[model samples]
Target: MRYAICFTPTPSDPLSQVAANWLGRNVFSGEMVEPPAIRGIGIHEIAFHTAVPRRYGFHGVLKAPFHLAPDVSETQLLRDMMRFSGSFQPFRIPRIEVARLHNYFSLVPSVPCEYMHYLASAVVQHFDRFRAPLSEAEIERSDPDGLSAAQFANLHRWGNPYVMDEFRFHMPVTGPVNLVDMPRIEQALRNVFEPVLAEPVTVANIALMIEEGTGGPFRVHSLHPMGKVSARKIA
Candidate 1:
């Protein structure tokens, strides 16, 4: 199994519900949700667009996934996460916009925030001790040769190349999309998510997620709040 630290919205949050329906899966509950109907896009097309994000659920990654080191235990990681959460306070993103990330689409901040970068960097550095070193096969899968010098160095040092200066906070909404499908997909997302995106969104908690096996759906393992006072623990 591998573990990842992610920023998942609270279960009761409207954004969470919208995201769940859009992706057709609830990461918190590990259950499927029916996708919203779109005039031009078929349910099959919606499912196709969502396939990749559905496996990981609806969240922006903080620390990318890694296997636990042989010496570490899940309990140790959880305890450390609790302590880490107590030291940080929540912040808000003033606005989010739908944008293309390579061939995929995601909700990203209209402007980047230093606090978001700091929070993500802290998570990557703080819990890195628990991460097992990448095996040759794992490194190969990452396609290190395709990475830039800095990214390659980061992958070797931190086990993930997307942290620190490279991190862009985004909640992915679709897999690689064909050029012809982009318009309809974007329209469908805007129709359902416009109202929620009009307001500021809070960055309140960090979710611990687990992938039971390779290519498996990641499920929410636990949630830790980002302020002095922790909320009721959830499994």
Candidate 2:
């Protein structure tokens, strides 16, 4: 199994519900969710665009997936996650909006927040001891030649190409979109997400997600609220 540390909105948060609907799966429950109707877009088209991200569910990556180091145990990792999450206090992002990152759509902060970067970097560095070195196949899959110098270096050292200085907090909402369909997709996104984005988003909880098999769906393992001493595992 591979483990990832990510930021998932609380189960009750409106954005969580929006994402669950958009992505066709609920990370919290591992249950299928029906996609919302998008004007000018058929249900099959929506499903096609969401296929890639649906497997990972709804989350903003703090640490990309990694196998446990030879000596590490899941219990130990969970304990450390509780301690790490508890050490920091929660903060809020002023606003977030749907934006295109390459060919995909993701929700990103309207302005950068240093606190989120700091937290992401901390997660990468702190739990790195628990990450096993990437396998040869893994390195090939990352397309090292396509990465910039910094990204390549990070890929080798951190096992994730986008870490530390390269981190950008984004909750992916769709896979690739055709250039011709971009405007319509953007409209649909705005229609579904505008209300939830009207207010500041609190960065209050971090979750541990697990993939039980290679190329399998990721499921929420537990949630750790920032500045709190406890963790709640989902059944």
Candidate 3:
């Protein structure tokens, strides 16, 4: 199994429910949700466009997935995560929007957030000891040749290239779409997510997610609240 640290809204959060419906799967529950029908777009097209994000579910990655070191235990990792989260206070993203990220669409902050960056960096750095180094296959899978020099170096040193200075908080919604299809996909995403985005979203907890095996959907294992005061763990 591989473990990832992510920022997923609570399963009951309106944004989470809407995203799960749009993507046809709920990462929190590991269950399929029927996709809503769209005029002029076939269900198959919607399903196809969402296939990639559906597997990962609706969450912004904090720490990329990694194998546990042989000497590490899941219980120990959970304890560490719980302890680590206790030091920080919760913050909010003032606004969010459906934006094109590279070749795909995602929900991203409407403005830069220093607090979000700091939180993500802390998560990446703090739990790194639990990670096993990438295997040859994992390295090959990441396609180092496609990465920029700095990103390549970061990948080697941190196990994920997109953390720290490179990190942009994104909750992915679809697989790569052809540029020609971007306008329609963007409209679809905005139609579904805009209402939820109209209000500020809370960043109150960090979630521990688990993938049972290769190609499996990640499921929420636990949520650790962020604050200086001790908080209850949610499962």
- TM-score for each prediction? 0.95, 0.95, 0.96
Model 2: CA > 4 A from native: 228-235
lDDT of each residue in 38-82, candidate 2, tens digit only: 778887888888999999999999999999999999999999998
- Compose the digit string of candidate 1's lDDT tens values, residues 157-234: 999988888888999999999998888888888888887888788887889999968879998999998776543222
For model 1, the run of ten residues with the poorest summed lDDT: 226-235
lDDT of 1: 0.89
TM-score of 3: 0.96
Clash-forming residue pairs, model 2? none
Q: Which residue ranges in model 1 land beyond 4 Å of their true spot?
A: 230-235
Return the TM-score for candidate 2, rounded to 2 decimals.
0.95
lDDT of each candidate versus the true structure: 0.89, 0.91, 0.89
How many clashing residue pairs, candidate 1? Answer: 0
lDDT of 1 at 207: 92
lDDT digits (tens) for residues 1-235 of candidate 3: 9999999888888999999999999888799999988776777899999999998888999999999999999999999998888888888888989999899999999998889899999989989999999998898898999988888988999998787788899999999999999898888888878988888888888999999688788889898988766433222
